[model samples]
Each structure stands twice: as C-alpha cells, then as structure tokens.
Target: MKLHGVDYTSAPSRRKGITIASGELHGDVLILESLTSLPDHAAFDAWLRQPGPWLGAFDFPFSLPRELVEHLQWPTEWAPLMRHVTSLTRPEMRETFKAFCDARPVGGKFAHRATDFPAGSSPSMKWVNPPVAYMLHAGVPQLLAAGVTIYQLHPGDPDRIAFEGYPGMVARDITRASYKNDLRSKQTPARREARERIVGMLEAGQHRWDVKLDAGDFREALVDDGSGDLLDAALCAVLAAWAWQRREARYGMPEFDALEGWIVGA
Candidate 1:
C-alpha cells in the first residue's frame, strides 16, 4: 500500500499551500516518491478524490475534545458532531470557543483531548498560536465530503484510511531546539543546522519508530525550506509508513474515545 503524509493549512495560498508527501514503504525504509502542493481547497479536494489503496497521516485534529463537546452539548456522535461544527461560520466558532475559554481558569483555559498530552499537540480548540481550531473547521468538512475513512471515527472507503499525525511529536524525539521559522529574517544558520540534524537522524533510523527515510535528492530541499513545511510533510510520511508497518495492530493506535480521535505514533 502507498503511504501519504499531509502538512495542512486552513487557508491555502501560493506561499502556504497544503503540502503532501507520498511514498512507499520498503522494508524498514520510507522512500519518498513525490511532493505535491495544493494551493486551494479545490486542489485538496481533487487530490482526496484520487483512487487510493493508500493511507494518509494528516497534520490536523480530526475531532474536538469530548470535554468541550459535552460542555457545549453538541452531538455526541462523530458525523453529527462534525455536521454541527461545519454548519457554523468561522466567527461563530471563534466566539463559541472564546466563550468556553473565558469561563475557565487562566492556565486551564483550553479544553484538551486525551491524545493531546501524549501527542504533544496544541488544543484543537485553540484559535491562535497555530490556530488548530480554524484548521479543524476548514479541513474536516472536506474530509467528510470526500468520503474517506477516518480510521476509528468514521467509515467510508476502506482503501483510503486517514490517521491524525503530529510532526512535532517526531521532531521533539530528535531535538528540542527550534528548527523552523516562517519569517525570512528568523531563518538563521542555527535553525538550518537543526534541520540538518533532524535529517541525519531520520536517515540513520534514530527515532522511536526505527524507520529510515530515503529522501534522496529531496534531503537538501527538506533542510533548506526554512518554513519547514516540506520537512513536516516528510516526517508525517515517516509516521504513516510506521503505521502501515503495524496495520494489523490498528495502525499503532491505542483504544481511545471514538469521539476524540488519536494522533498516530503519539
């Protein structure tokens, strides 16, 4: 089976498109085959419609925290919950999430999914500092419309499986130093060096999955892209390949609430 990894953006543009890495798993190595950029949601939708005996690991939250959902009294079921969420406008989502946060204590403001701590991901309800809530609003609806299977959460085409992946988790395993920045001025040699270190670790199969990365000529490109979009997509590919290796074991996922999806290899 082919494996795919997506570095998604809520608002895609020429500069910050949804970046995808497609590859095949060969023994313990993931050979990245190609990188595709979807500059708009239309492009992403078209990509999703492609025929698949493929599994994708997307860098976005698949569901909201059950605690937040229960507090909001939204639909408990996955499809119904997503349907309710998609019906609202972005402003509506922001205000609602803001109200939720406003009612809680300072440090404990944001509600978190069970997977967040293990995955080292931001709260799906957060509207800024990555704005994952907006990402969920923008991305999940498209996934639902495309009719792809969302692993344990929803059933669609079994050949097209989707798993939530956190590239930060993989990067943290290799180094705690900041390795990426979007601003040209902040893209220093230090960050580039960190990216080089990450690439070396991946090629050497030094991370938790013990899966090597064969990026070939793309290695320099991954390190050179100071925004880290390409590298994040590549990391997601490695995680997807790891999941493919453990397909019979539920894609290396633990039994968690279906209402709150998991981050693969968390």
Candidate 2:
C-alpha cells in the first residue's frame, strides 16, 4: 500500500527518520499543530480560508457521549446539533459541557456517545487530561470554516467518513490502558515496557485494523533539519501507521465526498 500524501504545514514537518510508504498524501490531510499554543480567532480564521487536503481532524472528542448530549438537552439531531454547537462561544461551550459533567456521577463523569469509546476518544469536555473540549473549540471552527463535512454518527448521517479518528482508542487497545501519558508517569519501567510492547506490535505488523505504523522507521531519528519539526507529524505518522494496520471496517467504511466533508479537487 503506497502512502501518498501532502502534509498541510507552514514548514516541511515530516520526520527525517520516516521510511516506507512515500507518496504525497493528498494536500488536504492537514497538519493543524497549534502555532502559538493557543492560536487566536484571527489565525484560526486565516487558516480556515486556505483550500485544504485536511478534511477534518483527529479530534479528542469528535462528538460528546450520548448521555451528555441528552443531559444538556442539546439538539439531539446532528445537523442542528453541529449548528447549535458552533453557534456557542468558547466560554459557552466549556460552561455548558462542564455543567453537564458536574451533575453526573463521579465514576461516570462525562456522558459519552457510542462512537466515543469505540473511537477511543478522550472526553472533549474533560477539564484535565488533554481537555478535548478545547480541541473542539480549536478544531470545529476550522471544519466549519472549511465547510468540510464530518463523519457523524448522528440521526441522518450514519455512514459518513471522518477526517480525524480517535486513534488513541486504537493505540490503547493494542497497548492496553497501561501506558499513561504524563511525563513522570510515562518514564516508569512498567510504562516503558508497555510502550515497548506497543512498539513491538507496530513493528511486527500486529494491529491489521490500523494503517501500518512502521515504528522502527523513525526510532533512531532526532528531528527534521528541513522543517525543524517532527513531533506532531510523527504522532500523525503513528496514527497513520495504526490506521493502516486496522481492518477497513474500523474506518466504518467512511464516505469521502463534498457533502461528506472532502473538498473536491482541493
């Protein structure tokens, strides 16, 4: 399988270490690494205007859990729900999701959708641990700005193709929930073992459901001299590896089209 694609970037971001599967990924498979940590509305607006190979993003929380959506009495329908969500301001989205979470039981803090767990998605609204609600705030507007469609599991659109996959879900499954992400936690021997094992799986061609991860390809590299960038793309490379490893069904047989979210000929 030839991995042909272009990275949406301010600079060439691919790791100098990457090998195997080299072809330009269609220009739209974007790279949205935050330029300034918390990019403002203007920068975001500017990014949106550009034509994209990026259809959507690997959102931490592509959608909320079913229970949470019901709890807030947010629009149950997809089109209306997306419209309503985008209508809200940053603070508005945060406050609303937070209020809904606060009212729930402790173990089950946030309401999740069927897609959430399946996608191995982080709770977009979670206050700590990636706080994907911010990702939603950061990402959703870009989707809307591009007018790219999302692969939604909502009422009308059951067979949509999404740009961002909850690859962490796939990552966790192959590795199990053993490897926690924080710095101190990840350095432990046990976590190292877990990560190594995770690496082993990729190298061995284990998780056939995701794309080939090709972990060994970049294990020795430091950084890209040309781009001075690699971490985010490396992460995405990992995502693509896992995605390549997966069985096609895991993509849920996503549909790619203008209405489905891809920019035709863009």
Candidate 3:
C-alpha cells in the first residue's frame, strides 16, 4: 500500500483518445444522447489488462463476492480451488455454475458482482442480478491466473505479495449508504450530487492522502451505473482521476504516503 500507482476502467470514452483525465469529457462523448461515449465491455477489459503501474479497479473484483463463493461451494478458498478456478476452461466453469443455478429459485439465483457494494450484495449465486452471475463467471477465473490474492472472495488475507483493489469502497463513503452504489434505478439525483461534491473536493485539494495510522480527513467520489458492468470501472475512473492528480504531484499532493489508508483518502 505504498501509493505506487492508480487504476482506471477504460470507459465513458471522452473521445477517440484525448483528455482521458482532465475532469473534462469530449464534445462527441458529451452529447448526452449518444451511447458512443460509453466504451464497450471488450474495450473496458482490454484497458484493464494493459500493463504497468496501476493499483486496481472497479471493472470486476480481483475476487468474487463472498455470497457467491459460499453458495456455489466452489471452494475458491485456499490453495486448491483458487488454483482450480485459475486453470478450468471457461466452458467447464460455465457448465458447473449453470448446474448450480439450475437448481436454485427463480427470483433469486445468479451470482452478484463484488462491486455491488453497500447495496447489500446478494447471495452471489442469486440470479436476480443477472449478468453479474456471468461477471462472477468471467471475472474470478482471471484473478486465479494472475495469481492475485482472493481470500473469501474479497482479497481478505491477500496474496501477501500482490496489490489489487475493488475501488468501490471509496465511492460508498460519500453518503455512507447503499442505494447510491447501485447501478440500477435507485441511484437518485441526490446521489449524483454527492459524488460530484467529492469529485469537487479532490479538484480543490481538500483532503490528506497520508496513510498514517491516525491521519484523518478522507474524501471521495461515487457514481451509480445503470448497468453494473461499468459500475466498478466508473468508480475506477474516479479513482484514476484522483490518481492522475496524485501522480502528477509525485504522490505529494497530500493524498498519499506509507502503507495504509485508501488511495482516495480512505
């Protein structure tokens, strides 16, 4: 946690490739009516897998939600299962998960995404959330291969050597609640305003980035996605936005330090 680098979900494309982080969106991407501004899922993951000094992101969890891990009884716990998921083919993974869901209730079935923070994530195996089931499907396997630490499906104990992040907790601090975290309909205008306020805070340099055991003053941004796919990614953008600042400042912008505290101010 030495404030090495930041993470971003290649999303909400502001242009073909420009101002990627100037607190400004491109004219074409800002039309407010065109979906062109939104980056595709493929593009998003591609950006995430890019090499270099990033911390982590909201694209999808480095780990799956605890709820799903337990329900599937996939044993993604210690060494074997963790190693298991890492090597299984996507088809094998699909068939196995499909069987489990096939036996669950109709209203509540698929797995939930780890980014469904504060919203009180489902049992993960609960399908009412849909795609996240697939997220749990597509995401977890990758973490295994990368050798990233994914304890209890949340980076609990950690790999001890690796450094990855979920990035959504930073956003949840805005209102200290869940609804605002949902990408679904519950994300109200008030929630949007709260996130904007925190973003404003960063722009004005209003908090300490120090990771001391006792350093206070933390501030961050939050955004509710209509589709949870980009929820974590968007949150990562916000994290990266702040990171862009901290990095530009050489980690001396009062928002970074030793081996603790969240990148956003915690």
Among all windows of 10 consecutive residues in model 1, the one with the lowest summed lDDT is 209-218
Highest-scoring model, lDDT: 1
Per-residue CA lDDT of candidate 3, range 78-130, in tens? 44444555566556766767786778799655654433433333333332343
Full-model lDDT for every candidate:
0.93, 0.42, 0.37
Instruction: Return model 3's CA RMSD, one decimal.
Output: 10.9
Question: Model 3 segments beyond 4 Å from truth?
Answer: 1-49, 62-73, 76-126, 143-168, 176-192, 204-234, 237-266
Q: How far off is residue 222 in model 2, in Å?
A: 8.8
lDDT (Cα, tens digit) per residue for candidate 2, span 55-103: 2223234455556666677876655666677788768887887777677
What's the lDDT for candidate 3? 0.37
- List ranges where model 1 is wrong by over 4 Å: none
TM-score versus the correct structure, for each prediction: 0.99, 0.58, 0.42
Every candidate's CA RMSD: 0.7, 8.6, 10.9
TM-score of 2: 0.58
Better by lDDT, candidate 3 or 1: 1
Model 2 CA deviation exceeding 4 Å by range: 1-57, 152-162, 177-193, 208-210, 215-217, 221-266
Sort the candidates on lDDT, descending order. Answer: 1, 2, 3
